[model samples]
Target chain A: MKRNLRIMVIDDENIVGKRLKPALEKEGDIVETFTDARNALERFSEQQFDIVVSDIRMDDIDGLEVLEQVLARSEKTKVIIITGYATVEVAQEALVKGAFDFIAKPFKPNDLRTIIEKAAKELGR
Target chain B: MNITSGEAPIQTDDPQFSHHGLGEEYVEDIALKSRPIISIRFRLFLAFLVIFAFSMIVALWSIYALSEIQVKIRFLEAAGNYLTEIQQARRFEKNFLLYGTNLEDSLEHLRTAESILQKNKDTIEKILGRNSIQGMSLQLNNYHKVLEKVGEAGDTEERNRYEPELREYGGQLVSDATNFVVKEREAVEDALSLSRRVPFYFLGILMVLIIVITSFLVKNILSTLNRFLEYTNRIGEGDFSPILPKRKYRDEFSQLGLAFNHMIRELDKRHKILIESHKLRAVGTLVAGVAHELNNPLNNTMLTAGLLEEDFERLPDEEKLDMVQDIIKETERSKVIVRNLLDFARASDYKIIAMDLENLLEGSIRLVHNRVKLAKIELQMKLTPDLPPVHGDEQALQQVFINLILNAVDALPPRGKITVTDSKSSQAGFIEIKVSDNGPGIPEHILPRIFDPFFTTKVKEKGTGLGLSVSQGFVRRLGGNITVESRVGGGTTFTVLLPTTEVPSSVSAAPSP
Candidate 1:
């Protein structure tokens, strides 16, 4: 059997973290979630994760910073950016920052799960 | 507290009123506020009339003086002739006494002199007094009697007696005639000198009157013209208040005032529509942010509902119910966001009501939240809690704040801070609200004239140059004002001073200039 994947989801909206934590956990993987980007970044320094999922817009630290910080620590980790406004500039910028994938907001949990699985598959390489 | 965020439509709150802020009533009302036509021409005519009457009086007095002088000169000539006749009679008397010549000629001269005295008795009496003229006539009769006595005497002794009487009367007559001629000539000279002085005196008085009238008219017209010149300057700065009557009587300038009021109404109408258009443009700007903002709640709802559907059978009742509640709450949140924007886009009159500046300021900040977020600017507000309410139009005030905030956002780089601070002003009954940014400050040269209409540093597409001009106009109309302080490379702050009140303001009566 494949090893359990590690995932962290950061969104300022508490609901996103609360709901996504349980939904992703059903896949038999460990998941961490944060409603604040600062706390999320603090927690991120203490451990290693296989994938980082973060909303692009945040109060203190945005998703692009999370992506840079995550990659600076562990290049193997996959960073996926989530955005409420999926304009081309943001999508292009996120992708340019070594983000593994970009997803617009309001997507079904399964859609994100599929991207995470793909990111997981790539982590094995 | 947040009526704008409420679901009920804003228009229903004031059904009797409409978005059409003004109508033709004001134009007609102002144009028709005319008093009687006390035109400038009428005033000039009255001035000339006074001058004309004064001139006629002077002319008539001069004519009277000339006539008096003529009468004196005529009487002087008659008196000179009487003197000549008396002297001639005396000469003839001397001849008759010396050579025994015929006395007829002397008698004839005496008769002519007496006739002259008789003919000019009234005039001579008027000049020399009734008593003096009568004494002179008695002397003349005595002299004539003496001469006749000398001529009628037959012996030398008789003639000798008459000779002394005749010589005495003759000397008296000559001296008296000379005195009358000298006094009457002096009277003629006095009358001529008086007539000459009359014209000079009239000229001095006329000059003084002309100066008085001319200065009065010049000052009246000039002061009014200066007032109008100042009015043009005020109106050019975007003050649209009508020119009201300051004088008791009307004049041509009053008609000009009416015309100014008319022009102001039209200009104000065009400016209102411009502001309306700018508001629409602002709404357009907010729509993009609003659309992006809506997705946050929608995203939450989607994630929650999706999970609920996937785990519907396996989930505990509590978990399912929580997901359902989350979905409902998120939907309600979405509704409020949309409603707030809709209320701002709706047009309203300059309706004055007591409003919480804190709530209104916060709402304005929220409207531009997306623009600020997109630019990564840090926007914050520090309002003193429990501050008294201010009187203003809610929609218009929101626009004012939003414009200020948006301008700050545009001027800032990413991570720049925009601080909105408010407190009670030092002036009584007013609150001062300041919107400040730490971005590269506006240059000092451009600071003062930023409130001028069509004066903008931004590109044509980005700015209509009416934002601050329109904002200042609105605030002044409500008896408030906006001021700005800026330093080159330091920062910029816009302070809006608003009056706090409990009653609906009679601000429409306020002269905005």
Candidate 2:
């Protein structure tokens, strides 16, 4: 039996969080979505997750900062950055901060599924 | 003919006054335009002809008057010679009588001398007749008869009996000779005076005529030319309403004025037509831009509806999961189209900030990648690693790059290559972006109008033509420069120069020079 993996999605867009929640849930993962990075960070402080997927640009806090906060709390936890505003700098920065991989916006559901599986495997979930 | 080298005397030749307030380039262009493509040589030749004709006429008149003076001088000279000869003859006759050298013998000698004198008189009349020594033949004949009467007294005794008569005859001879001498001297003086006075008068009259003729010519031609120049200056200053006046003489200037008037009328009509066309094109561009914005969301809606229709049939089955994937994909597509539509139609208050240049360029490239793929154009980028940040709005700069990329794609034939390059210009303190194409370049006539709003080389249906112009506006708003260089049939290059500054979180920093 595959244990249900814990996943947190941080994105400003309501539709993205809404759609992505069910999609990740259908992959047999316990999914959590926070439209606010600050709230997500507060939630992240009290809990543990198998993987964290963050959008690069948000109204309150950027993905790089989100990566920083998450790494500060738990360096071993997997961080997969998802962003519409992907660039070499963002990718390199996210990767250097111990993110799993960087995915661009409008990504296929399979891409998300694959990344989350990799994170699950990395975590031995 | 001498060009005065001393400070060039304020150059009235340069028509511009300081107050007209145009740039040096514009003024220089105006000045160059003022000197039309008229043949300077022809004008010089015409001026020379007028002067030469006047000089030749003066020369001919002077020659005629001088020749008349020469004739009078010759006539006076001949008369002077004749008077001197007559006085010599009388002196010779007196010398013979005073010395009482051989009375009857001298009278015989005198007769022989008279015969010699008569022969010489014939020669004198012959020479004087060819000259203008008028009325001198009769005087010579009278002097010859006086000598004959003195010589016809055959003997000295007969001569002594008629001594008083001889003395009286001698008195008459001396008196007649003196009177003749006085008359001839007077005639010679009159002729010499006439010779001197007539030439002076003729020369004076000739000088006056030359002055009058040259003044008339210069006034007539220069005033006419000044009028032409004034009108041309007005035309150059964009004032085209002057009615070109005609001359009754039907000269070359008149013909040129008529032709110029016709040309200006034609140009004015063409300019009006061009203005109207430009307005129509602007309206068309607005309509097309609106249409393109509307079309994107419409397309997304159609794709979304199609996916929903497909997904409704696959429910409650093993492939229901596949149908969910399809729905998600379709929804993402709809989101993309909606986002693009908003970006295109959104009113923007762009703000500039110091941003990482490499990141900005990559983002712009990603934004336009789908279009590049759709156009079948290759997008080649060569971004220098560790490049500095630039001061600009990322979105606006992205729009500029996309506009240039789209323009390049349209300019190219299918599958052609478009290269986007980035490099640091140390001297400019800016990041230079070059988007170049290997397409057939813009036509020569259309090159200047490339950045004008609504001026398009593409067909009416194919382009709204606001891309380059809007790019220019955006670049300018960001305190940057965007310019295009095109070679007909070779290719086109769009260069965007953006001011570079410090990036906040970058590791390596460039030294400020």
| Cα lDDT tens digits for candidate 2, B183-202 | 55565566567656766776
In candidate 1, stretches whose alpha carbon ends up further than 4 angstroms from where it belongs are A1-105, A108-125, B1-38, B52-56, B145-152, B155-157, B195-199, B306-319, B346-361, B383-400, B424-432, B442-458, B464-485, B495-513
What are the lDDT figures for the candidates, one per model? 0.83, 0.61
After superposition of all CA atoms, the RMSD between model 1 and the true structure is 6.9
**Candidate 2 chain A weakest ten by summed lDDT:** A14-23
TM-score for each prediction? 0.77, 0.42
**lDDT by residue for model 1 (B109-160), tens:** 9899999999999998998899889989999999888888787889767887
Residue pairs clashing in model 1 are none
Q: Output the number of the DockQ-best candidate.
A: 1
Instruction: Kindly give the stretch of ten consecutive residues in candidate 1 chain B with the minimal lDDT sum.
Output: B1-10
Compared with the real two-chain complex, what DockQ does model 2 have?
Answer: 0.03
Cα lDDT, model 1, residue B119: 93
